[model samples]
Target: MRLRRTVLPSPDLLDIALAFGSFGLFTLPVLIRGSGHSPTAAIVVLGLAATVPLSVRRRAPVPVLATVSLVLVGAALADVGFTVFHSNAGPALGIAVLTVADRLPRAVSLRASVAAVGLVTVAEVTAMQVHPATGQNAIQLVLAVPAWLVGYAFHTRRQAERRLRSETQERAREAERRVRAEERVRVSADVHDIVSHTLSMIAVRSGVARMVLEQRPEEALAALSAIETASRGALDELRAVLQSLRDAPGDPLRTAGALAAGPAVERPTLAHLRSLVGNLRDDGYPITLALSEKAGAPPPVEESAYRVVQEALTNVVRHAGRVATSVEVAGDPEGLSISVLNAAPAGGSPGAGPGSGHGLTGMRDRVALYEGTVAAGPCPDGGYAVRVHFPARPVNRTAPADRAEGKRRG
Candidate 1:
């Protein structure tokens, strides 16, 4: 990605200012002192050389250091001291050394610093005839060494900050990948539950309509109508799933609560349990339902209960033929429990046809969403049973006591 440069002060402008400021700080003293401290032509030239090269310090720090160091030595050789130039090169050389250390590798910056100190010490010794370990050499070492050290500190800080930013970005990307994978699993499970049950009923009803079409027109018509109703309902549920997919990110209407909002379809709850049982009875499945009088559960838990029962009954219809099956549901504020029992198939095979497929997997997935558990196995007396239990609260729904009191008042 191309990053656009923001509007800020230019580096070149700042460098130019530093260059001129150093020139004036050094030369102004000579001008202020008049002819009494008049600077020679060589002195003026050497001072200009020391200050002008600072303008390009950021781009070529090492080269600027070399140039300025050369000028310092030349001034020392040509009798340039406190009166003529007044050590203007000290601060200017410090700035250049700092720039080099901050931008370049540690080894390279260290070598440049050593070279600068060596050159300045040699010039001071030759000019003033000072000893090798004198105060002048000590002063030069003190000034140059600290500047490089401070610049290296800044370089280390910048590197640490950049590494931290990169790591944070990588972690965020990994988290997003995990979320998308989970969303895919969730969408697949929902689609499986919605499509599998609806299509199974339609297939059974279609077969019934075909068999009865030649013998009883009325019965055949009823079966065909049932297929039509089932198909339309399936289409509606499928549309709701599709709508949820559209409400994902990158959509203009994708607000904060859009994901939890889901589709506007009426989710099936325990109140529809009776109608579900009635419909299964109409299809000639020998299933009995026993629900508690004061069963209360949250909407999500209720929806999960309804689906668990639906999947259980569908399994009975497919694998057990017309065997006797029983469904029991009981709940209070603390939790809800469900159990479905069925006599094994006449052939004695427990998980025949759709019984051992994704149907059970889908059921377990749904129940687990509510932190529920399911156990399905053959009973000792020759039957199969599925049981589920999940925690719930009765605070949001009507209890049996309240209903009975209302009935008495009425």
Candidate 2:
């Protein structure tokens, strides 16, 4: 096993050198006899045993270990050179070490390592005992055991490094994915806030325009200018919002909601729903409003309800063209449902169906912010239907104050 483990091309060639080295040692007797002794046969057997076990060491470690050990015993018994058969030894033990460090039980690896050390001690001691007259010291002979132990330590360290690097890379990839996911979330939030807020202001301004168109034509014109300013504000904000989305996700801390809009004004309510409908109806498309709740407790809920209707009607006028737009709003202490259904556009887009589809999606996001749900699809009868629902809050009406502060910016 050790022999195969270390059988790299550069060092394996040394086995041939080992064999040749053995041959030269064996032929020394022949050179001295000068036509007498021939140790060629013994050298050939030692060379064969030394290299044979290397072929299958990795596939069958135990078998390779047994084979090399048997050959070592044979060479030792034959009173031949030990290192000649030692070429296969290192790889067999190295493979044994790998096996012990891997598949075989821990106790088994320990036992095998201990047994290997003991066997090496026995082999070296016997070599000295059998040839004491040669005067080789035991210390020099026993060095192979230390060499095997050192190789084992190196393989262990290399395996540990590979595992550590693999785990660290996996963690980094996971962190990057999490960061990307968070960035997407932050960008979506910003977009929803900016789009919904700006669109609501546009609807409010449009109403203000209709109110003044007849009574104060000059104020109507001023409202139109404000509408243009608000639209431009929305456009510019949307650009920055989209850019934020394209950036990498938050690293240390998640990004917060849209930066405060400075001192805020009272958001709109059901009272404003009329002017909203009046403006569109005055434009060309007729409009109607019906509601179930007469109480005024849920301000955000009312705003969300009004917004849903406003978005639906806007889509109807945009898509159904001149088709009459109608809104039905129902709310109780428990929940509220708002629906706007309009006929198919004569030829115009519903802010969808062609130019872009982000409008409906943005509306849905707004409704969801109120913990509400919205569904928009082609109504079975003919035309598009938008339905939204918001969980109720205690009815709260600040219409008196809201009106005083109601945006004249139309």
Per-residue accuracy of model 1 over 354-388 as CA lDDT, tens digit each: 45568778777766655668888779977779998
What do the candidate models score in CA lDDT, each in turn? Answer: 0.71, 0.55
Task: Please list the residue runs of candidate 1 whose C-alpha ends up more than 4 Å from where it truly belongs after superposition.
Answer: 1-12, 22-56, 79-89, 130-138, 247-281, 286-313, 322-343, 346-356, 360-410
Task: Give all candidate RMSDs, comma-separated.
Answer: 9.2, 15.8
- The backbone clash count of each candidate, in order, is 0, 22
Candidate 1 lowest-lDDT run of ten: 396-405
**What are the TM-scores, per candidate, against the unseen true structure?**
0.70, 0.42
Candidate 2 global lDDT:
0.55
Q: Pick the candidate with the highest TM-score.
A: 1
What are the per-residue Cα lDDT tens digits for candidate 2 across 199-252?
A: 655665677699989999987897788779768766765654443332223532
